[model samples]
Target: MDGKKAKQEIVTGGQFTIPGTEVRKMRSRKGDRVYQIFVSSPLEEPPSSGFPVIYLLDGNSVFGTMAEALRVQSRRPEKTGVVPAVIVGIGYPTDQPFSAVRHCDFTLPLPESELPVHPKGAAWPEHGGAEEFLSFIEEELKPEVERDYRIDTGRQTIFGHSLGGLFVLQVLLTRPELFQTYIAGSPSIHWNKRFIQEEAERFAVRLRDAELDVSVLLAAGEIEKSHKSRIPEHAKVLFSVLSELESKGVRAEYREFEGEGHISVLPVLISRALRFALNPGGPHTSFSSV
Candidate 1:
């Protein structure tokens, strides 16, 4: 092909957007940071109870994957058991898949003295805004989304990965009633000196005193090497705690994706997370490496 013809062909297309999706920007009341929200609703008519909704973190990265998955799978609900749902992706306004500013929004508050030093002696990014971020989602984002769509309030879900996954756990533990389902993929259980482990333990104690009608899916990659020794162990510990609480109305499962590393596990987890979130009545299996 001629150089001119090839260049023209490559540049012919306009920007691409997922079907049935809308993008909007809203500033958070809890902070000055503005978030780019991506919303995708199924083309089909909603169920009488309204559509279940999934709120995803790292929107720029996984919004298309999850949105398209639902679009295609929900067409064969009888066979796939995947129901149509609204997807809301919470992300920063950026062309990149993930924003460095996520560090501030996804981490829990930690005293400066308790913050861990960087392994290479470099400085860490601003962090510890998870509380405010949660407030923004609950007070601002959820209300706006509800006003725009008919949402099945009882079937709300929250999903996250890495640091975002840590924030998901924070919401589940501190405000278990906020979301009916929580999908945490490759959560940074080791963050802040394994502070989430302590939080899990505390949640377990709380579970003993009160029943929680919630479902959780915790997953990680089989070959994740950063915290190889501790991630799975911590995941299993938390899984065990949740599994024992089945009588208390908690359904939990843990899965390790085979032949995958940290980042590679995301797409695989996205598909499984959809199934788990939409079919909450399915059997809850214990720790398994798939």
Candidate 2:
């Protein structure tokens, strides 16, 4: 609507099949530098009404999958019984470096680890910019959606995986008002050796007086531990942390699939996680903790 007709393209990736949503490429200036911005929305129905929205991080990997699940799940409301919502896939344009982008976008603080063999090697050191990333979502992206689409402004949810899951948790704790439900799968709680453990503690104390009614669903697979590493152990500790939150009037649920693995659990469990996360009744015993 401004300088030039910003170029748009049709792309397919992530957790959904967004047939009508066209991808628009834009740029954002963070301080002094510019970063490419890519967003997908329904082309035919810009202002889609009665649809809640799901803002998915890592839209390239998980957006289409989640969209497909919502498509199927929306048809059989009797099965999941959850309302279908619009899927906003946030992606990076070709210009930005993927690792640095995610590293700075999803993390909270630069973590210093005592161990040497960390997953994040030395060169790509940008970390802990989640607050800024959330700001981009609330200020830049959400406003665009609201101006162009018919979205249910009040009912929003966020879904993420691994590091993205860590970002979701950070947003929940720091800005619980942004979304009503939170979904995280196989999150890397081992970040900075469970830095989120301490963040969760602060969130619990703040939530007591705030009375923030938020729902969270944490999911990991039974075989996540079989890799002969510390991931499974981290998941256990993450579960304990979430359980502690539940005891503090924060609605939470935990699910560990019997045979699912880390890489495969997203597709396997996203539907159920979405159901429980968005369910208005808050956390319930519909599924077993073990």
What TM-score would each prediction reach against the true structure?
A: 0.90, 0.77
Candidate 1: where is the Cα deviation over 4 Å?
1-11, 117-120, 225-229, 280-290
For 171-280, candidate 2 gives per-residue lDDT tens digits of 87667888977888887666654456777777767756657667787778888877544555766666676666664556777778888887788787777865674433
Model 1: ten consecutive residues of lowest lDDT: 281-290
C-alpha root-mean-square deviation, each candidate: 4.2, 9.3
lDDT of each: 0.85, 0.67
What is the clash tally of candidate 1? 0
Q: Tell me, by TM-score, which candidate is best.
A: 1
| Candidate 1 per-residue C-alpha lDDT over 11-101 given as tens digits, one digit per residue, 9 for 90 to 100 | 6658888789999999997788899999999887888888999999999999999999888877766566677899999998999999988
